[model samples]
Target chain A: MTREGINQLVEEHVPKLVETITTHIETLTAPQRLKEAMLYSINAGGKRIRPLLLIATAGSYGSVTNAAYKLGAAVEMVHTYSLIHDDLPSMDDDDIRRGKLTNHKVYGEAMAILAGDALLTESFSLITDISEQDLAPRDALFLSSRLSEASGALGMVGGQVDDLAAENCSLTLDELESIHRRKTGALLAFAVEAGGLVGTSPKEDLTHLRKFAEEIGVAFQIKDDILDVEGDESAIGKPIGSDVDNKKSTYPSLLSITEAKRKLRNHIEAAENALKSLSVPAPALFSVLSYIELRDR
Target chain B: MTREGINQLVEEHVPKLVETITTHIETLTAPQRLKEAMLYSINAGGKRIRPLLLIATAGSYGSVTNAAYKLGAAVEMVHTYSLIHDDLPSMDDDDIRRGKLTNHKVYGEAMAILAGDALLTESFSLITDISEQDLAPRDALFLSSRLSEASGALGMVGGQVDDLAAENCSLTLDELESIHRRKTGALLAFAVEAGGLVGTSPKEDLTHLRKFAEEIGVAFQIKDDILDVEGDESAIGKPIGSDVDNKKSTYPSLLSITEAKRKLRNHIEAAENALKSLSVPAPALFSVLSYIELRDR
Candidate 1:
């Protein structure tokens, strides 16, 4: 598929993915305020990159199943919940996210916490609810287990803890990479691998997909750092140089901007190589890689 | 089995349950601090009532399986996560829990939040980790789905949201019951029902166990209210009259003390009737009911 074709595919499916996510949340028999708080964040705009990656990878192997869409929604919900909690007064203490008031700002801290909790819990339930016809119980169990491993202490949460600890102190490049690998890479890897599993892709293809995701994950973060240093403030949503202002280390801080760009290119090339190793063409995944390399926000 | 025999059974199994729970947490390759925060809360003294209830129910039907122990651990982890979040400064703001500093007080708010998040995510993972030989994938999926329903937006979290909103306002008895039923009753019901499922008990018996759990759950909360009004501060591990001070509605406040006691007795009787309806003798469940009725703390 051409880049334009992949872009069109993303545009068409993003809305459907959002609908899938919202329908799940809407069908919940929870309190009105809680649902409102949850939907408020869900409706908040995002690029739906993670879900798209999952679907695209699944598409690379075969048809993207309905279970893939549900899994996509599940991953997005986990991402949103992490953001909600990270924006709390005691955490990042951010007032705005996605150009709107953060969850705690709108719902109050207590409600925001519960909203995050509910989202995290429901993500697993969402997985289990997928029909056996769409995805077998054994596969569902594998997906659920992998999701938790990617999001829990051994993955995103652990990385977040380390990131917080690293603030106000410089970290070695290896340490920095270690944090980002778990913090951001783990879930992205899960998204790609899950798509493979859902599509029943060969084990070797799944391994290559994981490597592709890992490279892109780091490349994506490095690109964000580079953009923070050079991109337009308006294009990025949040203010630029906030990392510098906060005295935190980033790719540009530890390495020169030119060197960080070089590293980013290296990762992108590595990702492309992983895609090349796949038995099937992955034009959508390649498109995603290009987008990550060039995206401003 | 006699009440004394049931008590002996509980005494022997509680330590084994703790060991199983601790082993799971210990095996996680998360950050040291994250693991410490999680273990600290897990080791903090509680009656381990939820896991015990699950195990006892399973035993009532047949010999308990290793999967039952793991499931019990998963439920306890969810319970522990809830308590950790509940004790946060922005939530209940309690500085202490189980006579020790709250997780936030010790680990700080950010780590406390992450720890809770890890616990919640891992609880589902734990279910998936259960061997298929011990518990079939279908049954594991069912348990995971039920757990999330009991603990997510529709259940414990929803009830908590309502409970927080009800503070400083009068609530009807029905409203009060509704809140407790979700906030506390849902997970309790899950523990009993899950035991039956794991033990491969008859579907009819599972229904009775759920009814038994539902009755005891409300009775448990009502008894908590009564204890708050009359029990020793050191024994309960907190000062009495906190609900009154917080202006939160409770059974003793909504109804007179005499009326509340009567209601508690009625629920206990209903719980006993539920156990009696089960095909298998449930002396262990009866012992638990008796404990709930008479315990000071």
Candidate 2:
């Protein structure tokens, strides 16, 4: 896939992803403050990367138009729910997210929290609904388990727990990697692997797809840490120096920029390596994976 | 089934529910605080009505043990999660639950919120695990759908939204009924219905069991309201009039005690009617439904 092809995929799917999510959010019980809060954080977009990954990965092998769209939408719902809960007054307590007042800040804390809970449950419901189509039952179940495992305690929540515990304390690189692996990496892996899990992708191809996603996942987090230190607030849409302020350990904090860049290179290679054995022509997925490691924002 | 039978059923399942929840809680990632808050709320002794409903309903028609236990434990997790979130600083802002400090009060607002999110996700994960079991794929899918619908916006969350919106206002009896139906009725209905969904119960049996649960669910809420005004706090674990202090609407608030009692009787009768035509003996379920309508604490 050419650079233009990747851009086109993003442009097309980003809008559709937003539309799907918007419709799903509308289906939720309304006039409640928390539901609104959840929508606020979600609609206040951040590139819709996870959904894009699902679509892009699926597109690499087949016409993932149907499964990709729903899976993409489902992942964003989960992501948005996590952010709302994480930003609650009792959690990370962020007053602003994406250049605006956080969900709890605007909608009040209770709704923000419940909105998160509702979104999480809605994710499973949405995925299961996809199976109502021609997709096989095993595909739906596999996809559901992959997403759940990635988002549940063994993955993202596990990472969040570690992240919280490690606050104000120094950590070895391995500890930080372990946290990032579960927190940031697991979902990305799911985003790609889920595409394979749902699609008719062969076992070998699916294995490679997972490897590609795993490497890029780590590199993406490293880039995020780097961007936080130097990126513009207007461009990033969040206050700079939050990691520093929180005394949180991060890639940039633990490694020199040169070393971080080297590590990013290694992960990018690992990501690209997963594509080596693929039977499907996946220029778009390849471009996205490469950009994930090197992109500035 | 007699009084001894109900007690025996509770004894058989409650210990297992407690053990399963505790074991899962112990496996939580770093930040012991979050896990502690979750465990505190989950293990706090209630009558274990929801799980018992699942088990008893499953057992009524045929033998139920393995899958029944899983569904029973899963519903309690969902119920526990709701309680944790309901007590958050932004929600009810309660300081106590089940005669102990609420999740938020013990672990701070943020951890309590995450704990709830975790439990909700875990519930779905628990259901999904059934896909690997002996049940047919479609049956597993049906079980997942039932669980989500009962707890999602159209059900438990919907009721919660109404409850939040009705605060500080004088709600009509009908309006209050709508709130309780979703907030309280949906899960209770699902609790019994999911048992049938996961078990060998036939379609007609499932329908009758759900009808029975729906009536008892509303009656359960009415009894709760009455107990709040008149029952012993020592047994109830919270102070009498907490509802009044919160300015919450209830059956007794909208109707005189005599009228409320009459409505409770009507619901209990409806519940019995739903079960009277069942092919299988469900004496324990009947007794429990009767107790729900009459219990003071």
Candidate 3:
């Protein structure tokens, strides 16, 4: 698939993936208002990077079963859940996310927390539903384990704690790398590797795919930090410079923009090189790499 | 085992179960404060009811193994995490829980939220660890599904949202039942059912255990409502009449105190009957029923 073809596939699948999520959550016996609150944020939609990557990676290897879309949506839900909780007054305390009101802003704090909790819980249930049909239970268990690990304290939650602790404190480039690697890199890498896991990719291919994911994942966060300094505000959507306002140490803050871009380029190059190690052409996967390199600028 | 024997078993096992939780959480690569927040709350130690019930239930069926203790600790972690979040300023906002400062009070709100998130994620991972050891993958998946359902939107979280929503509103008996049935009942029921799930109890036995759980689970909540109105404040520990102060509806408020006791008695009778249906003697499980009835009087 060409770059346009890959983008087209992503575009086509994201809505269906969201619909899959809405449909599953609808079956929950929760209150109507709680369901509405959950759906409100989910329906807002965002980059859809995680789901699209999982699908595209699986597609590249001819293992894009129908189950892939649901899994992709599940990953997105987990991401959204983290964002909702992260935006609470107690956490990041952001008023806006992705250019709209944060969950607590529209739904109130209690609902926002519950909505996030509901989403996280339902993400796992969605996997089980798929396993009941297309995927094996053991395979679903594998995905669940990976998802939990990447999002757990040792991963994104840990990074958030570190990030919060480092606020207003100058961080070395290594400290910056360490925090972002857990905070952002874990889930992004999981998105790629989840596709491999679901597709039952060979061990060698899985390792290469994971390397590709780690490199690009770090690159993606660095790009966000770089964009906070240099990218067009409208193109990026949400407010930038909040990091600066909060005195958060970022890529551009720790290293010169030129040096940060150098790091980003290195990660992107590493990602591209890792992709080449895969036996298959993986055109869609390559498109993913290019998209990350080009995003926000 | 006699009731004293069961009491001795609980006394013997609670420390081991809590130790298991502490050891597992100590291994997390999260920031120090987050781990501290988690341990502080887990160390506070409530009744150890959930894990003890799980172990006791499994034990009665001759399926209690060392792995069961770890699984019990995981359930306790989930319970502890919920309490941490529930006591947040955004939620219940209580200062003290289990006779200590709540997680947010001790670790600050940010670490508290992250700690709760970490505990929730680790709970599932802990189960997966047990599955990797003694359980079949499918069996672990089954347990995970049940746990997520009981704690998810349709379960505890949903109940909490409803409880929050109904704060200023009047509630019917059915409405109050709906709330607590989801809020407190689900996790309690899950403790009993989880033991059966991991033990591979026969379908008929599972049904009886579930019935027993549901009856006693609701009974437990009704007893809480009763204690709030009439039990000794010092023994109950937390300040009482906060429910009435909050003007929240309760069993005694909705139905008279006498009627509430009548309802409790009926449920307890039903629970006792359900226990007899299990093919196993379930002496420890019976003692659990007696303990709930006797506590906080």
Candidate 4:
């Protein structure tokens, strides 16, 4: 498929994915304030790259099913919750995200915390809901298990802890990569593997998909670092140089911007090579890889 | 079973439950500080009431399986996570919990929040681990779904939002009950219902168990209110009259202490009556009810 074809596919499916997520949050019987806070973050104009990637990969295997949408929304919810908490006063202390006021800036800190907590809790509930329908119980179980592993202590949260600890201190490239692998890469990799699971791809194929995701995951972060140094602040939707202001290590800080860009390109190539091992053509997946490589935000 | 027998049962099982929970936390490959913060709260003395209730109820139906212990630990983790977040400076800002420094006090606010997040995320992973063993995947899914409902926006977090909003305001008895039912009662109810699920109890029995749990859950909160009004700070493991200090509504604030105690007894009786509808006698469950009524802390 051409880039326009993939763009059209994303355009068609992204709205549906948003609807799925909004409907889930809208139908919640939670308190109005809590629900509003949750919806605010959910509708905060994210790129929806994670969920769309999951759906695109799943479509490569078979027809996109409700389970794909549900799981996609679930992963997005986790991503959004992490963003919410990451922006908290105690964490990143960011005032803006996705070009809007952060959750705590609108909702009080307590409500924002609860909103993040509720989103995280409800993401699993959303996954389990899939088991009642198109997905098998074991598959749902597998998804939830892997998701928790990817997002939990040994994964995203653990990486955040290390990142915080490493602030104002130099980190070896190996240490930085270790942090990013768990911090950001795990969830992205899970999205790819989830699509593979939905596709009932062979174990060998799942391994390759994981490798593909890991490379892009690192590339995604490298691009962010590069953007932090030189990309347009308005385009990125947050202030540039915040990483340097915070005195944190980044790809461009550890290596020059040129080297970082080169590293990013290498990762993209590695990801493409991993896709070559797949049993079937993955044009949609390839397009997603390009989108990740090119996205300004 | 006699009271001694019940005490012995709790004695035998509480240590095992603690071990189960600690083992899960210890096994994490997370960063050291994150794991330390998590283990600090997990090691802090808790009554193990929720998990014990789950185990005892499961025992009443049949031999408690590994699934029971796993689910019990999972619920405890959720309960512990809530406590960790609740004590945050952005939330209740309490410096002490369970006779020790609150997690944030020891680990800093960011680490505390991450610890809570890790625990909550790991709880579902722990549940999924059960699916690999003695519990059916469908059953594991059911427990996880119910757990999220009990703890998420519509339940614990929602109730917490209301509870925070209601602070310094006079709440009607009905409003107080509504808040406590979701805040404290929902998870307690889930513990009992989880027991039934683990026992593979019939649907009717599950309903009865839920009713029983709901009643006692309210009673548990009432006891907490009463204790807040007129209990030992050391025994309760926190400052006394904190609800009054915070101007928060409580059973004793809404009604006289005499009346609140009377209400507590009524709920306990209702809980006992619900248990009577079970197909088999639940001596262990009955003992738990008695423990709830008589406990000083």
Query: Can you rank all candidates by lDDT, best first?
Result: 4, 1, 3, 2
Q: Lowest summed-lDDT stretch of 10 residues in model 2 chain A?
A: A29-38
Model 4, A10-46: lDDT tens digits are: 7878888889888998899879989899999999988
Candidate 4, residues B78-173: lDDT per residue as tens digits? 999999999988788899888999999999999999999999999998899884568888888888999999999989999999999998999998
Predicted candidate 1 versus true structure: per-residue lDDT over B37-151, tens digit per residue:
9999999877678888889888887888888899999999999999999988888898876678899999999999999999999899889989999999999999999999999
Interface RMSD of 4: 0.6
lDDT of 3 by residue, A61-180 (tens): 776877787789778888989899999997789888777889999999978988988888888877777756678877888888888889988898999899989999999988988898
Residue A73 of model 3, lDDT score? 78
Off by over 4 Å in 4: A1-6, A131-133, B1-6, B131-133
- Distance (Å) between predicted and true CA of A206, model 4? 2.2
**What's the TM-score of each model vs. the native?**
0.98, 0.95, 0.97, 0.98
**Clashes within 3 Å, all models in order:** 0, 4, 0, 0
Cα error, residue B183 of model 2, in Å, equals: 0.8
Question: Per-residue alpha-carbon lDDT of model 1 for A38-153, expressed as tens digits?
Answer: 98998888767889899988888888888989999999999899889988888778887777889999999999999999999999988998999999999999999999999999
What DockQ does each candidate score versus the true complex, computed on alpha carbons?
0.92, 0.60, 0.81, 0.93
Per-prediction CA RMSD (Å): 1.4, 2.0, 1.7, 1.4
